[model samples]
Every structure is written in C-alpha cells, then in structure tokens.
Target: MRLFFHTISARKKLVFLLALLVLPGGCSRHKSPRYLYGSNCGICHHGGEGMAGSVPPLSGRIDRIAATPEGRVYLASVLMNGVSGPIRAAGVPYRAEMPLFRYLSDEEAATILSWLSQQGETKPAPTITREDIAAARAHRISAGDVADMRAKLDLKHPLP
Candidate 1:
C-alpha cells in the first residue's frame, strides 16, 4: 500500500515539473506573432515621416503580396536578402530601403512570414516556405531588382 502511494506521488511530481518547464515557453510574450513583428520588423516598419512614407504599412499587405507569383517572390526575397529601393505592397508603394538581416534564422523568418500572411487583412496570405528562404539566399540578388522596387514607392532619402 505504501509503495503504491509513493509511485503515484512520484508520477504526479514528475508531471507537475514538466508542466512548469513548458508553461513559460507557451506563455512567453515574445513568442507571440504580433509581438515578434513589433520587435523585429517593426523596428524599420512602424510609422513615422521616415518610416510611414518610407515603409509600406504591414497591416494591409498580406493581400497584396499574395495576389501574384511575382509579389510573393519579391516579398520573400526582400525579407531574406533585403532591398535598397522603393517597395510596393498591394500597389501601395513605400520608399524605405530595407536592409538585409543575413543572420536571421530560417525558422524566425518563417514565423514572421506566416504572421504577415495570417494577419487577417484584404490580401490573401502567402505560402512562404523554408525552402524559399534557402533559395533566395543562394541566388544572386541584384541591384536592378532593388531599383525596380524602389520605383514603385516614394523614399525618404535619394538612392546613392
């Protein structure tokens, strides 16, 4: 009888400890998609004369990026490698020259992309994959692509 009670108590203690370990990660503030964006992308993307006019608003961009193959390609590439010119999301142009974060992990990029896609805006969500980031990184991203994208929006500073 005592052995049975000890066994059950031990199981309960193990279960409790496991829950304690996992719960913090589940409830973490930065784990949230919105919070992640606000921390990372929002650094350069949030509004201002410098950012508002320069950065395309993220709130309504999912639909635009999902509208066509070219848009998705451009969107993913821009996030992976970064851009130096005007960018237009959903026909609305933003002039900020987004720089590359070459060190962002693939999982982090995917999380941000998935968050942007499901943001519940007019544009359909994009189906960006880890493979896409890998491919973008492998390719020779060009200055011309940047110039073309820049032409689509108004920028705060003139391109050098």
Candidate 2:
C-alpha cells in the first residue's frame, strides 16, 4: 500500500509540474504592446470613431500603400509617429489630428505594419520589411512630416 501511494503521489507531482511549465502565469501572457493596440486602439481604429476622427479605414489602405516603396515607407513612418492635419483617403478628404503612438517597440511597429499591409487590402500580399521600417525611421519624420509629404503629393488638404 505504501509503495502504491508513493507512486501515485509522484505521478501527481509530475503532472502538476508539467502543467505549470505549459501554462503561463496569469495576465502576463497577453500583456504585450500589440495587445494594447488590439484591445484599446482597435476599439476606435477598427470601425468606430477613434479620437473624434473616423479612424482611417485600414481595409484597402494596406494594399494601396504597400504596392510601392514610397507608400510602404510612408506608412511605417506614420505608425511610429502619428499624422495630423488634412489627409485624404480613396480621394475623400479628412481633417483630423491623429495622436502619435510612440510607445510601440521596433518589433511591434514591424508587426503592426506587416499586419496592416496584409489586412485583406492588397492583392499580392504586402511585403513590408524591417529595412523599410529603418528607412522610414531614418526619414527623421514626425507628425510634422505629414506637412512636407502632403505638399509633395500636392495634397493641399489631406485627410486624417
């Protein structure tokens, strides 16, 4: 009887250890910065009015922006920082100021950008790279960069 009890106890302990190893601690597993965006940013950026401005629809913007190098670079910069003032989408003008989100890490930025690029928007699939991210970062860009980019694009009144 003693031998059988010990064996069962050992088996129970082993199972408990395995469970601990596989199951991460509470809440920490989902605490990533990406989670912040999905839960919080998505609250508004998804389909609702985000920050008083209709969040730029991410559906088709991804493909339209990823097809060209300039577009990809432009998007990465916008994500790292934010854009404000007048901007346009699908030819419609939007006038709003997008708050900058600088808390995201480089990897997080890359992931968000890649996901945005592929969000059922583009046809061939977006091909955003870390290199493109670096280039966009190098643009020394900021919310203010929108002014210059818009001027170059001849967007006298771009949308948000």
Candidate 3:
C-alpha cells in the first residue's frame, strides 16, 4: 500500500510538471521578448519571415520603421489597435488583418517591438519604450485607422 501511494504521488508530480511546461504564460509572469514573440506573433509571422505574400514580415522593416517618430507612432498604434487591408513590405504587397494585441501591457509591446527591430541584417534599430506605447494608447483608434496611417508613412526600405 505504501509503495502504491508513493507511485501515485510521483505520477501527480510528473503531471504537474508537464502542465507548467505546456500551459500558456508558462511558469513565469515576466516572459522574454523572444518567448512572447513566439507565443503571440510567431504563429502567423513565422519567426518574422511572415507567410508568403499574405502576412508582411517584420525583418528589415521594423528597424527602419521604428527609427522615426511618426513611424514609432504607427508601430505602437498597430499593436494597440491592429491593422487590416493592403500594405507593402520589402516592395511586396500584402493584404491581411493583423489582430490586435491590446491586452499586452505597454512594457510588453515595447519589448516586442524592440526585439523585432533587431531582426535581419540592418543598421542599429531604435529601442521602443513603454512611453511610446502609452502615447499611442492615449488616443484609442480602430484597426482600419491604423491601416490608413500606414498609407501615409514614407517607409521606402528595400527588403533583401
């Protein structure tokens, strides 16, 4: 009886361990930007490479886009509100609806953007801060508005 009880206890422990590994948010509250990206953006963006001509990739583009003040606003707004409709990245056209991540905190959004900026071979990318995200959140806008905002930006970088 004692041995059987011990075995059951061990099995329970194993199950608990597995749950921590497989569950969302994992075992910690503060997740790394890479981990955050994997759980959130990686599903569609696929390591920032994107999905063919549908979803636009972040590599080579985020760094340049985040460099300017207006571009930074666009990035923040996109995260808060999401964006849909047609857009171009690396000269390729993309038409898709990027879901909103409004639930993410300002710090989390900023960190994710900063991580994206470092992707691909490009000049040093600017560090997006929580303040930038907060500023964008100050004025809540719809996803369609964000799409319109993207239309006005002068993002002319050619992706390789």
Please list the residue runs of candidate 3 whose C-alpha ends up more than 4 Å from where it truly belongs after superposition: 1-29, 155-160
- Work out the TM-score per prediction: 0.61, 0.63, 0.77
Whole-model lDDT values for every prediction: 0.61, 0.61, 0.81
Window of ten residues with lowest summed lDDT in model 3: 151-160
Q: Please, what are the lDDT tens digits per residue for candidate 2 over residues 89-130?
A: 655656746665556555566666666656654567777776
Clashes of each: 6, 6, 0
Candidate 2 to truth, TM: 0.63
Candidate 1 per-residue lDDT over residues 1-160, each given as its tens digit: 5575566777787786788788877543337766666667878776211254556666655544545555555566777667775555445566556777556666666667767777646444666676766766666576457456545422432221
Which one wins on lDDT?
A: 3
> Per TM-score, what order, best first?
3, 2, 1
Clashes in candidate 1: how many?
6
Model with the higher TM-score, candidate 2 or 3: 3
Clashing pairs in 1: 48-52, 54-96, 63-123, 63-124, 86-149, 86-150
RMSD of 2: 6.2
